[model samples]
Target: MADVLSLKQSILIYLERSGGLERLAEDCEPYNDPQRTEAVYRFNVSVHPSDVMEVDPELGDCLLHDPLTATTLFQSACFQVIKSLSLIGKLQTESQVNVILNYTHLPPFPEYTLDLCRFPRVHRPVRPVSMEGLVIAITRVTKYTQGARFLCTNDDCPSAGGFHHIRVHTPGATESAVVRNDFSCTNCRSPLTEDVKFRVLGGEIISGQQRTSTSESHCFVFLTRTDELCNSMRIGRRYRLLGIPAHVHKWPNIACSVEANRVQPWNKVSASFQRLLRETSSSLWRFSAVVAHCFGLHVAPPGSYNTLKLSLLLSLMQTTTDAEDTFHNVDLLVVTTDTLIVDRFKGSET
Candidate 1:
């Protein structure tokens, strides 16, 4: 007889077998470095069979199930694994963000989804307030550029806080900002006293279109990520991010960026540096071929590569700029060395 268990239980067993439950909990601890830690994220998967036996008798494989058929049941199982940790007071569910998975016809999948409940729920909305835009720029956060920080210095009471003097070290002179003289908490008359355990970011998010016309109008959205909800984001990509209405620094009436809670890529962009190098190389190879066939022979403007190379060489060697005619002149890489040591690379093509 085979042992039977709920899908969630089976998933937990698999996690235990894989030695991930405890490891994942430790990674989400407060003291852990956010950069080094692997974020707990979720994506959805569909469970179904890919059958094509009727198409061709020879190409039938109905007996074997589609290896990548993921169902919502799998998502429930995965969610239970993390939720158990959170219930046990081991994992902080604040940083973990659940996202919708992008479905594809791959043989295997890596992520599954079971999102949490939020104030303005991200998955499906009871209302229709949302912001969708491309991340045009991202700025690094620092200690000095925080939204707001407080100080209190009362050791006796539990709510007592310490004295806070906003001082930033300048280049020439080391001076402090306006110091607060409050000794008690504003809410209660208790002495001001508290420790700074949590970290809040003051980074800026510039999200909008790069190019637009007068007829085709587009508004630029300036966002600020003050809370810990905003994760590490990439630029030049579209995102369906969630945010609440927020005001600018000096202008209270003007609504700039909202406090971003969650961000998901609406449009995927290539993130590979090697891919870019390959594209540049491909263009250069095409250029090499085009110049060779067209300008080199010059017979019927065979527009041989010889002519192109000669033009480049002359433009490079003749460093004079024609202000009246050409206006702009090309400058080639100059070998500014007194000695030419013969090595293996002297005549070798890179």
Candidate 2:
């Protein structure tokens, strides 16, 4: 009698099962649960009569079918999951619901709604600013433009839009003239002009000249280390970069307590000078070793092939020898927050 009663109850369940009675459920974490290390991403799924074929053999045999009822049942199950989690203080926001729906990889049905309170806000990372190389050249005044001349920096003005202009006063000279031209853009050669004009940009001199202008337009564009910012610019000179309102000047041989020490040779025995030279030598050796190692590593793999080669090269160069530090030539690599300009004399044997 008990077996007969169980069979009757099973028969009633078979008629109510969706499709063929295969049950499926989605397992997603609720938002702001704080129980998980990371937020849960979501997805979507679709159900149909064809999708049901497991769990109940009787339902399969009977072929129960009802699309509308099946959809309602599926929606109820999903919402129940969400509501249960919400009541448990797990469902964080409406956005999380949307995430789960979309993550199932199915188009959202009209019955679905999203929760937004569950997710944390995202922020972007910040970056540091940097400058590029420059080369300044002082060209002779054009014949057509009397009392005017061009101080051409190594940078092509047309290529880099407008060039850097600096104003300077000669000790015994009067006012001069200047002129400029726009060149091609550095990247796209679309007849480029300055996207944004830099009015007060300044730099030290690497090379320059002192000459008379034939034209009225005397222009100085400090684009390179070898540029003359003054009317009487010269080679083997240094300058201070300053910009005050509309006036910009590249003052030459402007001494500061910081860099003034490097200008003179140490004829007297000073500990500071001795230490500076020693530090400079050691730095040069390290730079050379680093460069050589980098080059060797590029040729082959480090452990089996390039390793032996790099080791051999280092031995041959005597990079480990403290005595060999004297042979190394180390130029100063000056860096600043705003620029990476290197000051090297043009045609100098040193």
Residue range 1-350, candidate 1, lDDT tens digits: 11223433544554465454565455335424444332234333221112222322221221112111222333345456656556223323322333221222212221111112222222331111235555666555433323123444534543343223222211111112212234455545654422333212234443442222233433444354433423445566565544333333324432233444355555443656346545557575554455344543433355434655656645655343232465454543323354354343355443
lDDT of 2 by residue, 137-224 (tens): 5445322111111223334453332222222221112223212345433344434332222221223332222212232322233322
TM-score for each model: 0.31, 0.15
Clashes of each: 24, 47
Model 2 lDDT, residue 249, Cα: 38
Weakest 10 consecutive residues of candidate 2 by summed lDDT? 256-265
Off by over 4 Å in 1: 1-128, 137-156, 161-183, 186-216, 224-235, 249-255, 268-350
TM-score winner: 1
**What's the distance in Å from true for residue 1, model 2?**
27
Candidate 2 structure lDDT: 0.29
